[model samples]
Target: MHHDSLHALLVKEKLSLTRPRRIIFDLLLHKDPQSMQVLISRAANKVDRATIYRTIELFERLGIVHRLNIGWKYKIELSDLFVGHHHHFHCNQCGATHTLQANPMLETMIDTVAAKENFSPRSHQLEIHGLCGQCAGQPA
Candidate 1:
């Protein structure tokens, strides 16, 4: 997303575009979902740990970022506003991951299932875990 959009979002929310926040935002932009530790490492001498955590929390609450949960652990990424809604594919053996774009058929199935269960559909996430092609191609 554009810097102007970020500034507009903050202005609309009555929040200031602080330096730390900008640093964090720039780090996340055009990036894949990654852990906070990875983000902290990338930030290096820029933003501190606590501030990054707080800013991430704020961003999550403001829909600026989406948390991808793998059981209890999670990674953060730019929200749909910045990167369209998507699922995930994980290689359990190599710990590699790939982004899966939202599929209309899959979404229709989800909506149908929710309707059957009399539940309102808000959002959903799916993670398929298995060996990636390269790993699978390798002999045991």
Candidate 2:
């Protein structure tokens, strides 16, 4: 997304576009979903840990980022505002996460199930967990 759009989103959300928030937001734009530790390390004391956590929480609440529950812990990533809806493939062995394009078939199935149950579906999250190529190639 463009800088203007990001700024506009902050404004619309009633959030201040502070320096730390802007820096972290820009970092997220270029990087994939990251853990709190990873984000703090990347910040390198440029932004405090509490501020980073608060910013991430605010972004998640604003629908600007997705807080993913990948079993062991939670990860944060830019939401559909920047990229379209997508799934994730998590490598259990290596602890790596890969993005997958949205699957129309799966979405249809979910919608069908919701319809069958007379439930209105707002959104859904799907994560496939397994060993990645490099991990699978290694000795078990």
Candidate 3:
């Protein structure tokens, strides 16, 4: 989404457009989903860890960001509200993440299961963990 839209969203949510919050949001705007530690490091001491952590938590709570548990750590990214729903392929060996757009087959499977169990699904995330091409070619 555009920066102006993001600013508008903050206003719509009644969230103050603070420098720390804007800085972190801007970073996420440029980069893909990032871990808390990576976000902190990129801030380069311009923002404090506690503030970044707090802002992240607030963003998640406000549906401005989506948090993914990639087994080892939590990664934060823009939510479907802004970017649309998607999935990821995480390379377990090198800690790389590749975004995957919505798949019809996967969606059908989820819908079938939900119907079978009489469950109303709200949202879903799929993270496929395996070796990337380079890692797969390397001998153990």
Best by TM-score: 2
- Model 3 scores a TM of 0.89
CA lDDT, every prediction?
0.87, 0.85, 0.84
Better TM-score candidate (1, 2): 2
Write the residue-wise lDDT of candidate 2 on 1-140 in tens digits: 45677788889977678899888888788566888888889998799989998899888887788888877688889998888888899998888888988989989998899989999988888889998889999946
Report the candidate with higher TM-score, 2 versus 3.
2
| Model 3 poorest ten-residue lDDT run | 1-10
Top lDDT: which candidate number? 1
Task: Kindly report which residue pairs in candidate 1 clash with one another.
Answer: none
CA lDDT of 88 in candidate 2? 92
lDDT of 3 at 15: 74
Residue 42 shift from truth in candidate 1, angstroms: 0.4
The residue-by-residue lDDT of candidate 3 on 1-95, one tens digit each, is 46677678778888778899889888888457899989999997799999999999888887889898987688999888778677898988888
lDDT score, candidate 3: 0.84
The alpha-carbon lDDT assigned to residue 35 of candidate 3 equals: 90
Q: What lDDT score is found at residue 22 in candidate 1? A: 94
True lDDT of residue 4, candidate 3:
75
C-alpha RMSD between model 3 and the true structure: 1.7
